[model samples]
Target chain A: MKYVDEFRDPVLAKSLIKQINILVEQIDFAKERPIQLMEFCGGHTHTIFRYGIEQLLPKCIELVHGPGCPVCVLPMGRVDDCVSLAERPEVIFTTFGDAMRVPGSKKSLLQAKADGADVRMVYSPLDALQLAHKYKDREVIFFALGFETTMPSTALTVLQAEADGLENFSLFCNHITTVPTIKAILDSPGMQLDGFVAPGHVSMVVGEQPFHFVCEKYKKPIVITGFEPLDILQSIWLLIKQIAEKRCIVENQYARVVQPDGNFPGLDAISRVFELREFFEWRGLGSIDHSGVRMKDDYARFDAERKFPVPNVRIADPKSCQCGEVLKGVIKPWQCKVFGSQCTPETPMGALMVSSEGACAAYYNFGNLPELMALKAEREKEEALS
Target chain B: MTASVPGMRKRSGVLRAETINMSHGGGGKAMRDLIEDVFIGAFDNNELSMLEDQARIELSTLTALGDRLALTTDSYVVDPIFFNGGDIGKLAVCGTVNDLAVGGAVPLYLTCGMIIEEGLSVADLRIIVASMKAAADAAGVKIVTGDTKVVDRGAADKVFINTAGVGVISKAHKISAHNAKPGDVVLINGYIGDHGAAIVGARGDLAIENDIQSDCQPLNKLIQSLLQACPNVHCMRDATRGGVGSVLNEFAVSSGVCFKLRETSIPVRTEVRGMCEILGLDPLYLANEGKVVVVLPKADAEAALAAMKSNQYGVNSAIIGEVTDAPTDTVILQTSFGGERIVDMLVGDQLPRIC
Candidate 1:
């Protein structure tokens, strides 16, 4: 609670909001249209909604939830591969708890488990490694997912497995890179994002150097932000001040954790274990170059994809889902067609509706339903008139 | 009729097996020995000692306590049967007793049924039975009748317990979820989510080390005292599987009213909060075994709080929220950060986030 309570202090949050309001007043773009800033991490999106930070901020600024949740962006084909691997009698599939609910082509891992698959939820990859050691007869496959924030741990675990001469341990690598996906978003046509609130955890691993492209090349202000209400409020203030002053640069609002050069040992481990894939498929945003990683040839023994038979078939997103638009901040989640009706957290039809970190699921679960419905109706009316 | 009498035959049987097997549930001498040694030894009472097929309760005896009977049942299949603070046995007894108590009843009798996987150690079963007996004694309830079955090793978990309880409600008290009205203050006995956190920690999957213990105890004594002080209690429920959030939602939907809870007022232990923060879980939706959600009029709020505070189980009792008229069938939380969010019923089990 020492580190947590201080960041959640309401007094500090109120003071930061006052500063953000003053900065918004000075920016001329606010009078014409709302200054839309995007928080690129699902963790930040969660904090924004959990603390109701959007409702507290001035109306001139709007926060767009981004597609940084790794679970939310996972393609269905990969999940299908996971289910197939888990169903194998000789394998033990272990994954983070949230990933168990992501629907594959046939069924989610939860369903596969109920149907007699050996799927287990583990906190860390090391736990999976331990299972491999305990049950040497069974192959333990860790469903490796997340961004750079989690890459190091998975890499270190793989290295540990190698050192221990673990033959039965392998990784279902879905680890993605942050900078390329951010680049994809910046390159998106009709994108009107004013600035960016970069993920704090990812920055802690890869550091501010990776995000320099957003400011230097794209000329957009980007602040590395933490996953706390006060951290988000302060990051918003930093983004707005940069806009008001006509300055574009990468700033670290979570300086206490995120260093300028990033973590060296973690980076070293990652580089040793993994290499960028030619092109990786995302659920909503399809086929980003060098966005995902696979185990290097040296560590091929630890790669589940290479070691086991997988049904690696491509599956497209539902036609009714507008998750791509939502990910690009082109439309709010409620503006999507099947948001509350066909697609819900209970029975998600889209990847964005599957995970709590997903934009649509976050809005559906945390946003006021009555208010969202009214907004959706108003938006539909405006679109009809146009 | 007494075993101590000089001419009376010794009714107690001695069990010699180290572990339970199919024979223990075969309804033969092995079954009789198991019942007499393990269960009857711990839960000793005249009614249970009779070994009848069913527990026979005199109508006059039940009438003496209250006018109406309250019957409720629950099954416990918690993993890691033995956890910090309590075991599955204690949970079985307390769960059923609290269900009856929440309805303004004086819990008196419970019927236990167990389905156990074969190859379980007899020593472990004794420990569980002793825990159940101790919990029953604390709640002033009798385990009058029971049944047991054994399945093949892979058929079931180590053990599963089901308890059905009977209690009598007085004519003066009429507590129901539908009775909640606007301006009624919502109160809880103590900190929430301890039992849930303890279970998660005990499971060892997360490998998080902490001293958190389950708050699994009977709430009958506390409820009785509260009812005496505030007889007009409108709604009451044990925050069990879904914690306080689901209970509030149920009250809101049933009464066609809204509950506005104060985030700062709700009591959550620091350790539990830490666990929730780490796992991306909301303590609001975590499970609680001992906590109870009470709703009553504002005028009697002080008396209810005082009555709860005086009881051992309700020492940390506090008013958490109040019922409101508008926004019917919704539960809202005024966050500590000066914002409000709807507290909806959980769609499914709360899964831990990847990050």
Candidate 2:
């Protein structure tokens, strides 16, 4: 709490807000009409929702949810394959909790588990290696999921497994790069992003350089922010200032944790274990080239997909679930028909409801805008009046 | 003494369970067998007579609460050590208190044991310890005692925290999952699944920043408030490892009552929903550290909400669902669009080491 409390100093936050307000007043930010700020980190998106940061902004400023959710973007076909692998009698599929609920061709790993398949949930990829060591006769397949932030651990686990000669273990790699997903969002016709709140955690791995492409090519100012209320507020203020000044540059606000080049050994681990895939199908983004990482040819034997015969299956998103639009910043979470009515967390209709980083979940949990709170109050008043 | 039915034992190593075994939770003969064979025989505690249901203790305190309180301890072995919103320290304190808070007691004190890996930096240890102290302070509890053990570099992760808490509960505050009654309104402290997502994001190797931090805080204050405001509060549960869905199912099984939750009423963050989608995780099944589910009589529901909202930790509290008579022992979710579906208990550890 020592390092944490200092960053969230309400007094400093006020001063920073005052500075941002003064800067904005000087540039007449209101005249910009609509300043669209897209946060590339799922964390930033959640922070914005959690604190009602978007509602606190001026009318001209709008924070858009970008392609920050990795789980929501996972292609249905790949999920089906994971489920297929999980269903195999000899194969014990180990995955993070998120991967288990993703629907694939009418089935999920949870369903497979309910049907008596050997599907297990683990905290980390290393846990899968531990499982492999525990069950030598059984083939342990780690459903390697997440972005650069989580990929390093999986890579380390793989390198360790191979070095230790744990032949029964393998990884079903679905690690996607952040920059490509950002590009995909920027390229999309519906994307009206003016700037980006770059991911802090991912930047801790790939470094601030990877996001340079977004700034240089897309001409958008990117602010890498820590995952805290004040960090997000400061980042938003920075983005607003950049939009007002018509400036485009990549910035790092989370300087304490994220280094410009990132951790060399962590990057080395990822580079050694994974090879860029030419093309991978994202759940909503379609096939984006070089967006994902697969096990290198040398490590194919430890690739769960290669080690086992998996049934290729593809499933459509629930017809009413507008997760694609939600992810692309085309619409807000509440805009979806299934937002709260049909797709609550208890009975999620789509991947957005399943993943914790999904924008919809963020809104449902923390996006209690003043208007909604007021509405609830009004409802109570009306009840009394009646 | 014929060794109390020769408790359950593993054929191999003490830590390692041979096969995907079920000896861990064995009942009756198997349960005693496991305790004697693996636990009692190895770590021979004087108090662990291996009572089938619980470990009993007698205390000499004279108060409104019972003389004897059920005290338990556990260590969080979550991976990635530090998470988006919090670290293992906060989780350790809160998780320990939740065990007591949910048991209808005012968590009074705690003891923390830190297992630090050799190479772990002093900075990280300080952060975790600071978080533990902050969590304990927030819960209005103290770290009465602690121990620090440094293992070799590979022996443990950066850190693991084991915590034991002591609580005092009166007969009036005696809440449990089995106390849920038909026609009780089920309420949650706030949103669900933030802690799990925050931890996942903290891995820092993931591209997306799940800026959400761990909702790891003690709910004893909130529970005490609720007990004061509405004594009809029949049940209380911290929606931890199994999330809301599984917790509801557990209540249903224990109380022999059905639960029906509204889709529109349950709170979740849009970002969390999006991340869950991308990651293919169910926010319902994901863990929540600072959240609690309470079952109160319909008449006292509003009062309970008022009490919860007044507390700092329960600002966004909501009545997510209600206990029902239908189905008797099953949990059902009413979809936002008016469809009904079954909500089952989690079968396996969805996110293990999630604390």
Candidate 3:
């Protein structure tokens, strides 16, 4: 608790909040209109939503969610591959719980599980190793997912499986790097990003180098922040300062755990097992070149994609869902038509509603259905007034 | 030549290779026979032999306090065997003891049962046992009895712990979900989701390095201090399996009142929030090992907050919400945008294998 508790000083947080409020009020009233800031990390977006940080800010400032969630950006074709692997009899599909509910082709991993595919929810890639050892007769394929923060673990699992001489396990690697995704977001048409709240966990592994592209090329202020309320608040305060001064650079607010170099051991393992794919299809972003990692040639024998026969299922997002615009910071969770009505955490229509890091899901969980609530409230008021 | 008795027929060389298989949880003669032959044999105690789903215990007549006590039982199943903050052993004991403590009980004794998988290193087992001993000693509670069983290697994970604790409750300590009243203030001990995040980070799965450790500890002393400082405390509940939201829902239903929470008031660690966001999880629904949700009368709310802050475990404690009169038997959240939302009970599993 020594290193952990110090970051959450209530007294310091209060003073900082006071300073931020005063600063917000003092900004040029007529010179600048709404100061639009985009937080590129899904984690920061959720913190901003969960802690109600946006509601605390002045009306002159508008915060937008960026294309940061790896799962939301993942395309339908890759999910089809995982679903096909789940259909195989000799395989046991292991994945994070969020991926289980994400719709693939005609069904999801959860649907596949219900249909008698040996699907399991694992907390880590190590648990996948345990499953492989337990079911030695069958194949255990991990549906590897996530950004730089989770890729190293899948890489380690592969290396450890090879070292242990376990042939029944494989990785269906969908590991994507962070830098390219950020570039894709910024380069996209009509991209309006003033600054970014860089992901803390990803920065811990990639360590501020990959994000340099955003600073040098785009001139967008980027603040790598931790996931706490104070961390997000502090990062926002930093971002606002940078924007006000017309300076753009990568600043690290989470210095305690994340170093400039990052943890070398994890990176070494990742470099050993994975190689960058030239072009990979992201669900919303189409195909971003050099955006994702696939199993290296040496590990192909353990790769489920090679072992299993899966049709290259090219699918499109539901015509109504504006996930692309949502991910790119052009729209908010409340702006989505499927936010609380047709698409919810219980019955998700897209990956955005399924993952906990998904902006739509977080907003729904914390109650962003103001229109519905207001309607009910007005009815009650009218009944009393009459 | 030495003559061997039937009981001594199996020697070190003749011992069967140990492995955990699924039959251990099958609820058949294989489980019972294994329990009696291996587990009971190793443990060898009278309390375990009673063989009831519920434990029945008697207080020491020497310090008989004339009042009935509170009882709580908890089960722990964390993966990777160990973590950065603490291991399964420490979590098992602290979890159960904290439950009884927040229920306004003076934790006195505990009973533990271990379901250990075959092929687990004996050295690892020893470390866990030592951790349990240390945590119990720190809490001033005795592990009077315990049970141990080794299953086939595939049958169980490394180890799973189930601990039930008994504590003496004073008559003055009138606290339960049913006791919450309108105008009562809701408070949390500190930040939520630290234990869940630490366990996840310890797995080395996310590739993110977090200095975050599990906030797993005993809160009996803290609860006792709060009780003494403010006897008018209406309700108390530990934020455990379903986090703060679940506990608040329980209070609302039991007290037949509505509840409202402030979005800006809740405390959460940045590292945890980051992990939760990346993983698509909600801190409101994530588990906490040492956090609690309490409702107290407005008159004693300040006193209760001061008392909680006096303890090391409750340093970041703050009044987050209050009991309300609308939507009886439901819990609502007051969004920072001046909107109202329902904070419902946990449906199914949120985060599993996270103790």
Candidate 4:
């Protein structure tokens, strides 16, 4: 609690809130419409809701939860591929605990596990490699999924496997890049984002240079933010000050961890094992160019997609889901048609409702449910009449 | 040929197998040997020693304690059968005892049932049985009757335990979840989330090293003292699987009042907090083995706190929150930060977040 408690000081948070309030008043554009800031990482969104930071902020500032949670953005067809891989008798499928619950076209990995597949939850890809070493006879497939924050570790894990010449281990690589997704969001129609709070962990791996485009091209202020309540509050204050002074620049609020040039060894590992895919399908957002990474041809033997027969089919999102608008900051999660009625944490219908890091899940879990439900009812009645 | 006959030899059984097999559950000599040497050897009480199909108690004994009987049962399937503070056996005994105690009952007797996998070591079985006996003795409860079964290696975990307890509730105590009112205060016995954190550490999947131990103790003594000081306790529940959060939610819904908890007043160990932070888990929702949530009138809050603090298991007890009149049937938390949020019931298991 040493580092954590310091970041959550109530006194400091109050002062930061006061500063944010003062800055919002100085900005002339705030009188007309609320200034919207997007926290791109799902981790930051979790922090915002966990500490009730959104409630403490002034009404003039709005925080938009972005599509940074890897599990939430995983397309259904990829989940089906994971399920199919897990169901094979000769293979043992390992994945992060949260990914097990993501629904596929047929069934989730949890359901497949319940139906007698050898599915296991692991904290790291190395744990999957350990299983490969222990079993030796059966194939061990690690469902490697995450943004650049997790990519380095998985890449290093692949390097370890190769060094040890472990034959039974392979990766179902679904690693994604962060910059291109941000670009896609910037290019989105009706985009009204004022500033950006970039993911700290992802920034740690891939330096501040990658985020310069947001300021250079899009003319937006971006802060590489940490996933603590104080860090988030301070980042918001920084963004507000940038807006008040009419400046656009990339800044680092989490200077303690994220290096300006980024982690060299980790970036080296990522480039060594993975290459950018031409396009990758997001769960709610459609295919974005160069948004995903796959194991390079040199590591083809270590790729589960190549070693095993994957269905490799594309499945469309559900008809009722409005996760795209939620991700783009166009509408609040509760404003979605199926938010609480047809979609919930227990039986999620959209990607945003799946992971706790997802905007909808965060709202459902921490927000006042009765109020949201009442709002949903009002909206339904209005829709019925109109 | 009856063993009760004078000068008749008592046939004591002996077990030679090192590991459990199907024969241990076949209702044969091996099974009898296991029961006699492991269970009966440790849980040595007059009622259990009688070796009858049912444990018989005197009607007068039951009548003397209270006007009504309380019965509760719980199953223990913890992944690691053994943990830092307790094992599945101790958990089985204390879990059922606490269940009865929270109902303002004087816990008296317990029945244990075990389903073991084929490859479980006999030595491990002996240790587990001894742990159960030790827990029951400390709680002043008798393990009166039990059963055991063995299955194939892949059919079950290494071991699973089920305990059903019986106690007598005094006629004077009228504790119920619906008894809470607006002016009631919320109290917790001690530090929570220790047992949950210990289990996560013991599992070793995350490789996080910590000195946290499970707070897995019988709370009957603490409950007895608490009820003695505040006989008109409004509601009581052990925060087991879902920690204090789930219990508070149940209290709010049943009493139709709001329970506003101050985050700073809640006692959570630094180690548990750190672990939760690293794993993206909420300590409020973590499981506790020996913690209890007590709701009572504001006037009796001090006496109740004093009584709880005097008990062995309640030294760190504190009044964490108070009941509110409006926002009916909701649980809110005044966060450590100067903010508030709704603490809703968890839909399913709290999965670790992908950082």
lDDT value, candidate 1, whole model: 0.92
> Candidate 4 at residue B257, lDDT?
94
User: To one decimal place, how large is model 1's interface RMSD in Å?
Assistant: 1.8
On DockQ, the leading prediction is: 4
lDDT leaderboard ranking: 4, 1, 3, 2
- Candidate 3 segments whose C-alpha is farther than 4 A from its true place: A25-32, A261-268, A367-386, B1-181, B184-244, B250-258, B261-321, B325-344, B352-355
DockQ of each: 0.63, 0.06, 0.09, 0.69
Q: What lDDT score goes with residue B109 in model 3?
A: 81
* lDDT by residue (tens digit), candidate 2, B239-354: 88889988888889899998988877999887777777566467888889999988989999899899999999899999998888856667766544223455656544543211
lDDT of 3 by residue, B151-234 (tens): 776778889999998888787778878988888899999999888788678877657678888888889889989989997778
- Provide all candidates' interface root-mean-square deviations: 1.8, 13.1, 6.8, 1.9
Query: On residues B6-71, what C-alpha lDDT tens digit does candidate 1 reach at each position?
Result: 543355678999999999999988998999999998999988999899999999999998899999
lDDT per residue for candidate 4 within A120-146, as digits (tens), equals 999889899999999999999999999
User: How well does model 3 score by local distance difference test?
Assistant: 0.77
Off by over 4 Å in 4: A368-386, B1-9
Off by over 4 Å in 2: A26-32, A371-386, B1-355
